[model samples]
Target: MIKVSVLYPNSDELIFDKEYYLNTHVPLVSKLLGDSLKNAQVDFGLASGVPGEAAMYVVMTHMSFESLESFQAIFEPNSVEILSDIANFTNCQPQLQISEIQI
Candidate 1:
């Protein structure tokens, strides 16, 4: 299982639209990839420590690499739109992290 982590840089106004993210955005993402997407989970919150430093939120997605390459194929192209929906509550660009399964 690869953990796709997204770090949201925050401002005093950083907040996640749980309703939209869980209901709308998540569903849209699942549909976009069709069967390739599975066991989806979207996290919402300000990153620890960073919140005091500046403003940082995070979303860590645990997905299978094989099932998520569809998003990768168009990552750079549709990134803005892809993230815009979630960015509605964030203050800065999100930091992303992807790790290969080590176990």
Candidate 2:
């Protein structure tokens, strides 16, 4: 399994719309990634620690590294288009990390 964890730094003005993100933005990305994607998770509405940190974090879990490959292959300028859909709500770049599950 491969997990891509994105930590969003909270900002005063950039706080994401929880329902919009959950209902719209997330589904857009998930749809692009396709049904092959699995264990898709989104977390929001959290208390901030640092003043500059984002108010939310989103973690995407692929069934395996294979899914990651599929995702990257399709990633491109279209990514920018897709990103623009949610850009206004987030201030930090998605810090994606792929890690193998040891379980």
Highest-scoring model, TM-score: 2
Q: What are the RMSD figures for all models against the true structure?
A: 4.1, 4.3
Q: Write down the worst ten-residue block by lDDT for model 2.
A: 57-66
lDDT of each: 0.58, 0.57
Off by over 4 Å in 2: 45-67
lDDT by residue (1-103, candidate 2, tens digit) is 5665554544454544567766787777777766545656665535447785544544232333345666566555358766687665555565556666678
| Model 1 agreement with the true structure over 1-34: per-residue lDDT tens digits | 4556665544665565667666786676666555
TM-score of each: 0.61, 0.64
